[model samples]
Target: MLILTHTLYLNRPEGEIPIAIRIYRPEPKDGCWACTFEIDWPEGTKTMSGAGLDALQALVISLQMIGIQIYTSTYHHDGALRAYDNEEGYGFPIARNVRDLLVGADKIYL
Candidate 1:
């Protein structure tokens, strides 16, 4: 089991909210592995279960719950960038590179 806590900042209400994510795999039954997660936030909490969900998927679900959207695009067929946008029409500048984008993303999603 892995547990992580993060703080998400919102522009709509202009405040910070705490979020907790937990990921674990239950004992295999009939030789299949499944991933389960729980998300805790200021407003409410949610739990999900699935098969073969990776770390990125888990983070995406948590971010979606808090109303943040992530977009990725490739430029000129040479490089890639990511954008972080919220429901209130607020967006972060396009990241210079994937590494830079992941660094910013880790703060909110990890």
Candidate 2:
């Protein structure tokens, strides 16, 4: 089963909102990835966890397709939903922790 812990609520421009995130660590087997992530949510809020394989896979693939780089251990690239090609000399790597998730590599604009 997956566990969701260490939840924190933040006041954003969107008003008081609940944001929960989990770090997914995947293991490759039979060309499919498997792993668990640490989820964080509000202490008193109710959220769904560990639903179904189809849904989870869909969510993960969606996240990846949008360039949200999911890391295995915060140090290595488990895999990317988007393809990164370096056609220029600007050496931009995807391992820069959330960089690829939020902003495309610096070389993207170069």
Candidate 3:
């Protein structure tokens, strides 16, 4: 799997959450092209939570609408990038095919 990254900075709010996103892309030649979205928080922030997975799950739903089969990594205590005291986490997973994986009803929590 060849991994690539695309980062995004947000200056506005989406829904009731004030979140920023970073999108990472997998190598195009691979069977599937995958992406990761991360949330950015500012200094002194202490109550922002659940945005990452929620965003990821939402993305999966959106991808499924178009036909994308994707894979998400499992949740590892040590795998979280922006670690919190069980309040938040990070996941990096691959989508085997862009459209096929998104057709399931299971939640991909990584």
Candidate 4:
């Protein structure tokens, strides 16, 4: 089951490109929840997964892996979906508190 979907814009030499990110619902297995994140790139589709204690953790670990890949690769940090001119820059507004979800050092599940 799909849990979430996001469209990330990438800036290329020619123009901006849209990339698809899909996250699936976590499933319980072996004392943990397994989650999947799919990235639909122009070349092909790539899927990465991770396991955690709960649904949110699963999503976090899964997304962290994906985020690392995005930041390191050529497809990241170049485009903006909604235009804004601010020194602070654009930020995602989360309705819920995410302080508890933060993991430091080796705590991130690979």
Which residue pairs in candidate 3 have backbone atoms (N, alpha carbon, C) closer than 3 angstroms, thus clashing? 67-99, 68-98, 68-99, 68-100, 69-98, 69-99, 69-100, 69-101, 70-101, 71-95
Order of models, best lDDT first: 4, 1, 2, 3
- For residue 70, model 1's alpha carbon misses the true position, in angstroms, by 8.5
**Model 4: pairs clashing at backbone N, Cα or C within 3 Å:** none
Tens digits of per-residue lDDT for model 4 on 30-74?
Answer: 898989888777788898887899988887778766655554445
TM-score for each predicted model, relative to the true structure: 0.37, 0.24, 0.20, 0.63
Q: Kindly provide the TM-score of model 3 when superposed on the true structure, using C-alpha atoms.
A: 0.20
Give the 10-residue window scoring lowest on summed lDDT in candidate 1.
73-82
Local distance difference test, each candidate: 0.39, 0.35, 0.30, 0.60
What are the C-alpha RMSDs, in order, of all predicted structures?
Answer: 10.5, 12.8, 14.1, 8.0
Scored against the true structure, residue 110 in model 3 reaches a CA lDDT of 27
Total clashing pairs in model 2: 0
Clashes of 4: 0
lDDT of 1 at 91: 26
Q: How many clashes does each candidate structure show, in the order listed?
A: 0, 0, 10, 0
Which of the predicted structures, 2 or 3, would earn the higher TM-score when compared with the native? Answer: 2
Question: lDDT value for candidate 3?
Answer: 0.30
If both were scored by lDDT, which would come out higher, candidate 2 or candidate 4?
Answer: 4
Q: Which residues of candidate 4, in runs, are more than 4 Å off?
A: 77-110
